[model samples]
Target: MLHVNGEAFEVRDAAVGESLLFVLRERLGLMGTKGACEQGECGSCTVLIDEQLVCSCLVLAAGAQRQRITTIEGIATETPTDVQRALVDAGAVQCGFCTPGLVVAAHSLLERSPRPSESEIREELSGNVCRCTGYGRIIDAVQRVAVSRASAREVGL
Candidate 1:
């Protein structure tokens, strides 16, 4: 059993040896956790296991047992997450293949360090590769989100 997106899902024995990414996409139909390089280089299959970032493709299904796995689908409630909205507003999303992972990574970073510097943001999101963009815009997106979130917190929003 895996608790994902605040829902309990049972994984059949047939998928015991599969990767978490496989289980999330094929069996559970949670395609927001995209899988690009199965080797964990692309970072497209990134997910928050107990609030810690990990590549779903490299994480064995059984290894994620009892962990609080949060995917892109669980990042926001009624509207898109602040990170997601910032990415789109900053034009950081290009082909969108890497958008989900980027959003997840940004959310994780912001959760840990709400006011990360530009250098810190780059270091945190370095694992996520975006072939389409040069990453300048992505950095801008994360910065924008961090700034606005701080502003909101100050006002108790």
Candidate 2:
């Protein structure tokens, strides 16, 4: 059994060496976790395991059996998350192949640091590689979400 997206799923017919990325996208049909670089070089397979951002491609599926996993699908509800909306509003999404990883990384950063400096945001998101948008818009989107969240907190919203 694997815990994913706040639900438990029984994994079946999985090989011993199957990567978590394969289990997520292939076995469970959670295609949000992309498999760009199976060697963990690219952040396309980024996911949250026990609230820690990790490259799913590097993790063994069987090893992640009891851990809490959160994919891109798990990050948003019926309505898009502020980070998701901010990315779109700021024109950060280009090809969109890297958007999910960027969104997850930014969300994790904001959860840890509600008010991060520009450099901090860049450092936090350094692992995620966006081939498009040149990263300026992506950084801007993260900052926008941070500012919006801070304002909401101040207004007690």
Candidate 3:
């Protein structure tokens, strides 16, 4: 059994057949996690395993016996999350197919490195692919969030 997003589930007897994406979508009904390029090329199936970004499609549900899993829904704060707000502010969200994964990746990077440089942000989000927005806006969004967080930290707010 594992606890996900503060919910307890019985997976000890669960079938060892499906991928984590299938179990998350089919069994748990956590639709926020997307499935694109099931081969793990795209980060659409990205999720946090102990706060690290991982492709859910490439992971086996049974392997997550006692790990903490955080999906896009779970990572979202009551305040729309800094990355979410920055994406919207920078007009980075388009089509929205990639936003969830992008958000998760950005969240992971921000958590580990609060004030990452532009190159660092790019490296961290390299796993995610977006067909819209030309990536400029997305880059701008990430930078904006990093700047904002840095300012907050400096001001002790």
Spell out the clash pairs found in candidate 3. Answer: none
C-alpha lDDT score of every prediction, in listed order: 0.89, 0.92, 0.87
Give the Å error, residue 31, model 2: 0.7
List runs of model 1 lying over 4 Å from the truth. none
lDDT of 3 by residue, 53-103 (tens): 899999899888689988888988567998999999999997999999999
* Cα TM-score per model: 0.94, 0.98, 0.93
> In model 1, how large is the Cα lDDT of residue 65?
81
Q: How close is candidate 2 to the true structure, as a TM-score?
A: 0.98
lDDT of 3: 0.87
**Model 3: per-residue Cα lDDT at residue 157:** 100
Quality of model 2 by C-alpha lDDT? 0.92
lDDT of 1 by residue, 29-143 (tens): 9988899889989999999998899999999988888889999889865799778888889989989999999888998998899889989998999889999989999999988
Higher lDDT: candidate 2 or 3? 2
lDDT of 2 by residue, 87-115 (tens): 99999998999888888899999999999
> What is the clash count of model 2?
0
